[model samples]
Target chain A: MSPVSFFKCLADDTRLHCVLLLQHKGELCVCDLVDAIGESQPKVSRHLAQLRECGILLTRREGQWMYYRLNPQLPAWAAAVIGQAAEGNSVYLKPALVRLGKSESQASCCD
Target chain B: MSPVSFFKCLADDTRLHCVLLLQHKGELCVCDLVDAIGESQPKVSRHLAQLRECGILLTRREGQWMYYRLNPQLPAWAAAVIGQAAEGNSVYLKPALVRLGKSESQASCCD
Candidate 1:
C-alpha cells in the first residue's frame, strides 16, 4: 500500500478491531467477523473491503465465505505505524486481544 | 473507543499514515498532514476528521490550524491491534515512520 493509504486503513476503530480478529485466527468470513465483533453484516463487509484495499489484509473464498488475514510482507513504513500502535494505551485494545487469543485456542483445539 | 471503532479507523491506509505522522510529533494540522502525506488539503481534512471520530486521535485548533495526536489513553484492545500491526508486515508503515522521525528531528533542532 502507499503511505497515505495505510493511514486511511488504520483510521477506523472498527477496521482495527476486524484486523485484530483476523490476526491470530488467520482468516474469517464477514459473518464470522460480525459474530466476533457483534456488528451488522454489511458493516463488517465494508470494513473488510477497506482492509483489503489498504493491503494490510488478504482474502480467500471457500464455499461462500470470504476470509482474511494480516498480509505477511509488511512494508517498512506501514510496519513502523503498527510497531508503535501496539505499545500505545487503550482500554478496549487489551480485552479484545484477550478474547481474540481465547477464540484462537478454542478453534485450534476443536480442529 | 470500542473494539469495532478501532478496527474501522485502522481499515484505511491513509489514516494509518496520518496517525503515524502524529505518533512522534505529538500533533499536526490538516495542512501539515497534507504536506507530510502529500495529499490534497480537503483529503487530509477528511481523514483527520475520521481519526478524531475514532478516538485513536485527539485534536486541537490553534488559529486556523487544527492538529491531532495519538490518544495517550489507547484502549488495551486498540493497543493490542497496534502492537501486532507493528510486528506484522506492511511496506508503507516503516518508511513513513522514518520520514516522521526525520521531520521531528529537523523540527526539534530548529526549535
Candidate 2:
C-alpha cells in the first residue's frame, strides 16, 4: 500500500493506540486492547477493523478470541514509523503499556 | 508532536507529496514543490504551511524564496520512517522527483 494510506490508517487516536500497543506487546486480543486503552470493546474493535482494512494489522482467531498484531509483511519504513512513534512518544503510551502489562500479569485472555 | 498528529499531517496526498519531495530533494522551495507535484502554488503552500505548523518541516527564507526540509530535530525513527516511506514507494514518487529534477536541470528558482 502507499505510504499515505498506511499513515492514514494510523491518523486516528484509537487506531494509533491499537497499533502502538500491538507493536509494544507483539500480540494482543481485543480485550487486552480494551483494558489497555480504557475504551469500549466496540470502539476498540472498530479501530482495529480500520487498521485491518488498511493492511497494517493482521488478525488470528483462537476459539472465542481474536488476536491482533502488526502485519509482519509491513515494509521496513512503516515499521520504522511505528517504532519511532512509540519511542518518541513513550510518555503518551507508557500508561497504556503499563495497563496492558498489568492486565497480562493478572491473566492474559489470549492464553 | 504526537505520532497521530504527525501522521495526520502526512495523510494528505498533497502534503505527503510535498514531504516525500522534500525528503528526496533534501530541501525545496514552494515553487519547486508546486512544479514537482504539479499542484497549484496556493495548494502547495497550504500543505507546506500545515507541515510547518505541525513541526515536521523547518524553513529558511532567502530573498523572495522560502526553502523547506524535513525537521532535523525529528527523532531518528521519524527520519527512518520518512526514509523508508521514500524508499518503499519510490515507484509512486519517481515521477515527481523526475519532474523536480527536470525543473532544476533547466533552472532553479531557489538559486
Highest-scoring model, TM-score: 2
How would the docking of model 2 be graded?
medium
- Clash pairs detected, candidate 2: none
True contacts kept of each: 0.32, 0.82
Model 2, A13-65: lDDT tens per residue? 89989998888889889999999999999999998998898889999999999
Minimal lDDT window, size 10, model 1 chain B: B83-92
Complex DockQ per candidate: 0.22, 0.70
The candidate scoring highest on DockQ is 2
lDDT of 1 at A37: 68
- Per-residue lDDT of B1-111 in model 2, one digit per residue for the tens? 777888898899999899888898788888899988998898889889999998899999989999999999987767777887888789889899899889889977677
For model 1, residues B8-43, the per-residue Cα lDDT tens digits are 676566776777556646677675567567678788
Worst 10 residues of 2 chain A by lDDT: A102-111
